[model samples]
Target: MKVSDLDVPELLDVITKAISPVIFKGIDQDSSPHLWRERMKLHAEIVGRITAVLHCGDEVGPDIGEIIEICTRNMRAGYEQSFSEVLGPGGSLSKIRKP
Candidate 1:
């Protein structure tokens, strides 16, 4: 499915469901709204790009197994800083600072 086809809530649900088992491992319950929103936006962008490549029959992109791995890797890396910031001491959202 195209990532744009899913709304914010649906996207969040998909992400949460996909990573549910791993959430408790390190996710911060106090995650900030801004960071969470950015993470989700990044996730959707990546998903959409990957989907477009797959639909074009790109060899590497057409592989579901590899696609999932790429998506997960990209998302994890993209959110690492945000996740760490939220989960860090003093319950800070420092990672959301302006560029």
Candidate 2:
């Protein structure tokens, strides 16, 4: 099924359900301020990657496995760059975090 085939709510529901476990797992693994920032960065990277893939008109099969495969493949790419861009010296995240 293509992402466009799903209604807004259904798309959100499916994406949230699919991504929640990963978010929760990261949350469970760390509670420090630095790790919390890392987790949030990772979450943003994941959602951004998924959105990019969907936007590119990729085909997703009905099976959950296929959906996961797509998500995994997209999520694994460019993360280090994204992480550095967000958390590096003078990154936007630092500006936002500062009062």
Candidate 3:
């Protein structure tokens, strides 16, 4: 479906789903601190670009900022959950090592 066809809430869901998997996959596959840092930088740039586009669009307008915030929070929560699952209790990205 076209992005234009989606409402604000639907757009948030679509964006989160589309982006979160890539981040989770990166977290899972990154074998070194440098790789992980680079991947995260790229991800941040992508998300920033997307947010800028959404903010400029007449359809999203003023609500875009809040939507982006919520989307980011959801993505962070998903990352933390994935890390916890893979690393067990008290697990965090800092504890991840090449394996």
Alpha-carbon deviation at 94 in model 2, angstroms: 16
- Give, for candidate 1, the lowest lDDT window spanning 10 residues: 52-61
**Cα miss at 85, model 1 (Å)?**
1.3
Q: Write one digit per residue (lDDT tens) for candidate 1, span 1-99.
A: 554444655555575567544433333545565556555555645554554344334244446666666665665666665665654555464444554
lDDT of each: 0.53, 0.57, 0.57
Q: For every model shown, what is its TM-score relative to the native structure?
A: 0.35, 0.43, 0.43
Q: After superposition, how far is residue 17 of candidate 1 from its true place, in Å?
A: 6.5
Which one wins by lDDT: 1 or 2? 2
Query: What is the lDDT ranking, best to worst?
Result: 2, 3, 1
Please state the error at residue 77 of candidate 2 in Å: 19
Model 1, C-alpha of 68: deviation from truth (Å): 1.5
Estimate the overall C-alpha local distance difference test score of candidate 3. 0.57
**Candidate 2 Cα lDDT to native:** 0.57
- Of the two candidates 2 and 3, the one with more favorable lDDT, higher being better, is 2
Root-mean-square deviation of each candidate, in angstroms? 9.6, 7.5, 6.0
* TM-score, structure 1 vs. true: 0.35
